[model samples]
Target: MTDSVFTRIVRREIPAAIVFEDEQVIAFMDAGQVNPGHVLVATKRQVETVMELAEAEAAHLFAVATRVAKVVQATFQPEGMTLLQTNKPAGWQTVPHVHVHVLPRYANDGAELVWPRKDPPLAELQALAARIVL
Candidate 1:
């Protein structure tokens, strides 16, 4: 597979305002600023989506996101925060590589996160749950 833009950034071939990094993950300032400190946390081992992650890699990615959210809260001091992760194209994932977004949010920031409420029938919900549940 071709190396992603993120992989280039990881290799330091391109420059980015990186926030935090470890052997397993790297948290860098997003190219576009949602707030003062919108960060994208990505794994060094590239994959297209969260489903491709091993259980431990997913856990570590979110763990890093959780920690970064706290730091963003402390540094930016926004009223609230958001942790957004997108999947395939339909899910609004612009990049092919997997990453998580941490944005510091304030009231009336003009960013909207909404999904239409789909009230599925009880039988439908039960069937979906049965398929997913271990």
Candidate 2:
């Protein structure tokens, strides 16, 4: 199997343009950025997907993402911003590591975030929510 580039970054075996770091998470400049201040927030635990994250860990990851997004917004002054999380190949995730992409956007950037929106019936939604709720 191939080595995990993010794991190498975490282990300091490879260099990343790190922006922030704490015990739980790390934020770094995306090597292929959508915009100038684009950043990636990743869990330090080396989980492959969000489903493996504990509730507290997930919360902390998002908190750090939000903080980093705010700085990117302020510093870069993009017209808008996007918080992106992906799962596996079906979800457009290229890397195996669980990471959140903070994409800074601008006017006429030509990026597309199209997805189907299903407006299901209220009862169906409620039933699905019930099934999903823990």
- Compared with the true structure, all predictions reach lDDT values of 0.93, 0.91
lDDT of candidate 2 over 1-134, digit per residue (tens): 35578878888998999999999998999999878998999988787889999999999999999999999998999999999999989999898888999999988898788999999999999999999856
True lDDT of residue 109, candidate 1: 93
List the candidates' TM-scores in order: 0.95, 0.90
Candidate 2 minimal-lDDT segment of 10 residues = 1-10
What's the lDDT of the predicted structure labeled candidate 2? 0.91
Root-mean-square deviation of every model = 1.1, 1.6
Summing lDDT over every window of 10 consecutive residues in candidate 1, give the lowest-scoring window.
Answer: 125-134
Shift of residue 15 alpha carbon in model 2, Å: 1.6
In candidate 1, stretches whose alpha carbon ends up further than 4 angstroms from where it belongs are none
Give lDDT tens digits, candidate 1, residues 44-127.
Answer: 888999999999999999999999999999998999999999999999999889999999999999989898999999999999
